[model samples]
Target: MEFQLDKINPTKAIDLYRGMLKPRVIENKMLTLLRQGKISKWFSGIGQEAIAAGVMQNLNNDEYVLPMHRNLGVFTSREIPLYRLFEQWQGKANGFTKGRDRSFHFGTQEYHVVGMISHLGPQLGVADGIALAHKLRNEKKLTAVFTGEGGTSEGDFHEALNVASVWQLPVLFCVENNGYGLSTPTNEQYNCENIADRGVGYGMESHIIDGNNVVEVFTKMKEITESVRENPRPILIEFKTFRRRGHEEASGTKYVPEDLMAYWEKRDPIENYEKALMDADLLTKDDQKKFTDEFNEEIKTHLKKANNAPPIESSIEKELADVYQNFEPKNLPASTETNHIRFVDAISEALKMAMQKNHNLVIMGQDVADYGGVFKITEGFVDEFGKERVRNTPICESAIVSAAMGLSINKMKAVVEMQFGDFVSSGFNPIVNYLAKIHYRWNQNADVVVRMPCGAGVGAGPFHSQTNEAWFTKTPGLKVVYPAFADDAKGLLISAIEDPNPVMFFEHKALYRSQRSDVPTNYYTTELGKANLLKEGSQISLITFGAGVHWALDVLENNPDLSVDLIDLRSLSPLDTEAILSSVRKTGKALILQEDTSFGGVASDISALISKHCFESLDGPVETVTSLPTPVPFAGQLEDQFLAKSRLEKALIDLANY
Candidate 1:
């Protein structure tokens, strides 16, 4: 794209001037409010407004923009009302987040803006997902994601760029090189001459433009966005700008060199753009004054209305009510005729059936397409659904997980497989912070299901074998489903796919082929938040889930005289309190067994719940059997000691005799 200022349209030039000026005016007012204790915080985008203003003006309403905190121009250019933005800044009930989040920390589907979290890198991967969705649907839309120059140092930044380039997704990586990240300068950030150069490593188009020149930013982005929409590939644009203000109003710019600050002040984006517009005879001094006055008056009117609006206290109930979707467990009739299958096959069948039912469902993971996944759970999936649905992603956990959230933003469902359970730690930030909290923060549903092939017994060691369900069970807004039987696995997986919220589906690696049951070949759904009672007895209640169910069942089979009530908790987050309490109340004694370690495990939480709710009904103290708190070893003998089998048998006998 050639940079020809004379060729720029007068109307577009004026629109770009208004775009940059609106944010300059808004931020100045916000800074005043912050000083007066009217608003809590302010991340000033004063000197660097040209990048957002220019780029956002060229985008359509359908194209999504993931903006950082400093990109106020993005909201203004999208024509978001001043009053609503004021409400959001004021933490009023009528704000975009309904007071759940502050500042530009919320996404709004109405304006096609995906908000950024404090962790700046994760959204890059999310942009990949949104772009992936557009590519899959053959939509001529692209996603533009912004980050500071310092954000390029993040692992997610590299991973997102590589994945976007490899997949040839329609994404625009907009890097605003403001010289510093918080207090650290560019010299300490990266040794590269330009952030755009990093794009070359990813095999993508790259460009460097004057961030202070609104016309140049807009011109370059116009060409780049058009090319990406038509061709569908990633491109990186480095906007060389400076941050005149500190990271936030509270973080004073004592570290910024005085000479450098003075240089940026002279090359101010708004001042330079206003001059260029006037030079081109598109805007006059009087015209600028009128626009400034109108914007000021608009700000004043909106601020007054926002100040008068009720605080979060008024809508606290509604805010809490919107946290999770109210999905009642369906009581579908069980299948009478069935075919016996392994647990892994049941999940494959469920996914195949779900994809057949919902054309928008996508399954993504490493080697999931032709390789049939590391466990062969998705064998023959690519043959049925094609490569578009059965996506094979790079070794980027954080990117793929965050991408799943992106898919959900476009009303699409994504199933992400974490080759093994422990790998979830790599994707934890997006799962717990973004996917699990997006709904409560911005009323956006994260329709993502993460499949974790968890648990030990295959001698895969700590990295590959881990029953880490407890980590997500404690996180709110996430459904944790762990099935013990093939039938239950098929039903629960289908239900999780149909769910409008994020779900953590844990598939025990040991039970992939070991567990077999008569599962229905036809489509069916198993209710979440409901526990299944596999056995009924009066002596004691054995509460467990996943592989623990097999351990308990084996003990029951060996000791025929032992009267035990066995409960398999399919869902952990929406804990089946009634089922757990009822069995404990009937037996008057309870044992909580789990494959995860004892400390901070699901077993501990269940024990506390039993002790709190069924204290009077208990004959003695509630007992628990769990694996030792140690990293799983590869050696068979050491792994056995790390498991709960031997200790579970002893705990059952002790609790039974008591």
Candidate 2:
């Protein structure tokens, strides 16, 4: 597309100049503050202002933009208050993150901006989710995301682009090739000629624009954004620019050649745009000076206010309170009428009913739509809910998980399935870093449930079968739920969907088909932080979850004479400490069981809690029965030894006798 100045009105052209000038003014002042040790740090977008200012100016106020650390103009162009930005940098409580995070790392729904994580690439996947939401709602809006040329190397970047193109999602992938990734030059970062060229591989239109030329960037972005709003497909635009300053003030531009710095200095975005505006008679030299002075004064005023703002108080209660949403446990009446069903079928029924009730609920995973997933949990779902609601994704766990976070941002609930639980390691960053931290970092609700089909019984080898719930149970702002019975699976899944925070719902593959219960047919929800006392006895409290519940039950059934208080811990993160303590207090002897290995497992934590709280009441040590510390084997004989089911039976009898 050609740069046409005739297409832009005088007001928009002047606004564009102001947009570029404001961030430059802010950056200069911020640099001064950094030198004076007033602010801790800064990522200067001094020469790269036009890319954010020009592109963001073309976007509607309602459209979402995921900006990187350097895109300070994205905030300034959105007209986010200068005081708030200053407060954020100064680590004041009045900022968007309330001093929880620094700089552009925090996102605010008020400004329709999704802040980038330090990892840099996950936000692209998040953009896919926001765009997916827009397409589902038939909204004439698109999400724009930014990254540096170095970010293009991440798997999330490829996964997001491939999936967006395959789904025809309306996303604008903006890559600001600022000639360096920190100190690493463009030549060292990528082998490709241009970042835009890779867009062709993903079957998307690509463009390269002069990022320093604000007029060109503005006119071109207006055309591209309009086209995307109407067509609703992903487009990649490479904004060719240079970093005139160091990546951050502490890291000087010593690596950049003097000639290279001089070359980009001559093409400075603010200076070039100012001259262009003056040439078009849209801005006078007097107007330029007045605008700079006005911005300078405005920034100084805000900086003074930010400096005076109160620092975040160090309160343990307040710090703990911000981790998760204050979700009151709902106690719905248990259904009198019930249907006997397998655990897998119960899960399918719960999802089907939830989809029927909530139109915005979506399910995404590999082969989940038509193949019903590897386990057939989502069988016939695509036919019932249609492809839009029951979507199938490529084998990109990272992208799908981050996309779910994106969906949550738009008030849409998402369920992401990992074909096997062990694969969650592939998508771990987005879940632990982004999804689990989003609520605490910003007040964004991550209404997403990641279904992990886990456990070892079918000889599916180590990759396919493994118990990994311990990975997320330690992460704050995430709910870890593992259900053993059919009815609990149905009710707990319903509750997980309704939750406003991120939930990791683990469905033990071993129990999916083996377990059968009279599950309620109607819509219902079970409280999250509550445990069920299956059998109350005075001898020993068998605390277990998932497959261990069935294993313990089998042991109890075989030895009817043995008295045991069976406690099924439904949720792990919000562990039902009250129930565990009550049962252990009554029994005097406690035995914790889990499918995960003994070291660093949920059982270890529970044992510690029992020892600390139940020291006076306990008659013996709190012993734990767990799988051996090794990967699950494929052979049945070796697998059984690894699972230690027989050990659990013996441990129960010995603990009960003690």
- TM-score per prediction, in order, is 0.98, 0.98
Per-candidate RMSD, Å: 1.7, 1.5
Q: Model 1, 546-581: lDDT tens per residue? A: 999999999899899999999999889788999999
Q: State which candidate has the highest lDDT.
A: 2
Backbone clashes, candidate 2: 0
Give the residue spans of candidate 1 off by over 4 A.
Answer: 1-4, 314-320, 328-332
Per-residue accuracy of model 2 over 1-658 as CA lDDT, tens digit each:
1235687888888888888888888888888888888788899889998898889988998999999999999998888999999888777787888788999998989989999999998999999999999999999999999999999999999999999999999999999999999999989888989999999899999999999888789888989999989999999999999988888889999999999999999988778767766777888989988999999888888888887888777688987888987787566666799999999999998899889988999999999998899889888988788999999999999999999999999889999999988999999999999999998898898999999999987899889989999899889989999999999999999999988889999999888888899998888998898899999898999999999988888898999998888999999978999999989899899999998987999999999999999999999989999999999999999998999586988888777677
lDDT of 2 at 447: 90
lDDT of 2: 0.90
Instruction: Give the Cα lDDT of each candidate.
Output: 0.90, 0.90
Q: What is the lDDT of residue 76 in candidate 2?
A: 86
